[model samples]
Target: MLTEELLTLAAAAGAAVATAAGTDAWEGLRARLGHWFGRGDGRRGEAALAELDGSAAELLEGGTPTGGELERCGAAWRDRVVATLERLDGPDRDEAAHDLRRLLAEEPTAPKIHSGDQHVQGDIRVHAEQGSLAAALINGNVHFSPPPPPVRPEG
Candidate 1:
């Protein structure tokens, strides 16, 4: 049995993988995870890559996923991580857990929004580096106005 800390780490890795799918960081995260899971085996590495691709495809299917879908996908990956950790012995398990922590730490937390060709008919809230803000309702077209010029300071 794995320690609580290690189990938590595995859970976080799984969540991170689920969150990284279809985002800008997806490719890099996917490659690193594949290599980690592969553990120097070429066939295993290829299989891992295939599995990751399938996860991404499932999450990206249709469009925005429902909350249940996200939870299910995350749990699936978490189980995979836990199983992998269970197979390792002593130091190997610790090292794998450490690697997972590193991967999670390096992952970008910023959410990426891809509108693609979908049309939005309701209000949307956008969260970015600048901060969260409310978006106006959309009928069909979208427009953006430049920020007003900064006020000059009195000399």
Candidate 2:
């Protein structure tokens, strides 16, 4: 089963990347994930967010994750985050690293899976930037289909 700390790391990584990427892509990805999780303006998205937020208290033990898992999660997060970074190429990779360092100074929120018995074997949090970096690194199966465009409220 997945540990808690790893999941939190992924979340922090994603959040850092997203924050570095800026709010537009981050928000867009958030909306996309909302659709994938069937959370379009519903409690589902809220739940999903709740599920992926908190602290990593008891994850990251045992031997390092398998090679396949690391590739999967890393690819997913790298795909979205790297793409966005490339598009918004104001800061270089080194800058992104600096941003990540700043994020580490703050306590990051942990990803809370609903069921404990059903272990998460891979990264499933849609975008690699959503939950645990380990999940992205380990390829936990937490992702689903992308969400539709978010509807804006009228003034």
Candidate 3:
């Protein structure tokens, strides 16, 4: 049985696979995932690559995908990852999990904004609705001051 941590990691890997499709990171992620799944078998590696390519092609077929489609794709890959992990045993499973962790850590991820520790590496947009306020502090401080009063015209 897979531990909670391993399950979480597999789910994340699945999501990463789905998210990386069609992006600049796609090729690297695909190659790494294929290599991992291949497990030193050339034919298996080629087959895995082909499967990944098909997934990518399907994902990118109609331009941007709907949220439902993306979720479906993610779920499918998540199941595949879980199945792969479940098939291994003992030291093999441990080593495969380690490799998966390494793969995830090495791959580039989209910009993330977290409380007290925001690290953005790509374009970020900050928009405020009417009568609202918005702020995005990349690496700077912000100061707020009252607007100057309108000057009255001399008679």
Assess candidate 1 and give its lDDT.
Answer: 0.67
* Candidate 1 structure quality by residue, lDDT tens digits, 1-155: 98756665665666666666766677888898898899889899899999998987878675666556665777788789899999999999988877776776676631222223223222122323466664544566665543222122222
The collision pairs in model 3 are: none
Q: How much lDDT does each candidate structure score?
A: 0.67, 0.36, 0.68
Residue 152, model 1: lDDT of 20
Give the TM-score ranking, best first: 3, 1, 2
Off by over 4 Å in 1: 110-155
Clashes of each: 0, 32, 0
Highest lDDT: give the candidate number.
3
Please give the lDDT score at residue 117 for candidate 3: 35
lDDT of 2 by residue, 3-109 (tens): 34334344444533223222223344444443433323478667534432211001112223333433443444434434433443444544543443344433222
TM-score of every candidate: 0.69, 0.25, 0.69
RMSD, one per candidate, in order: 16.0, 17.0, 15.3
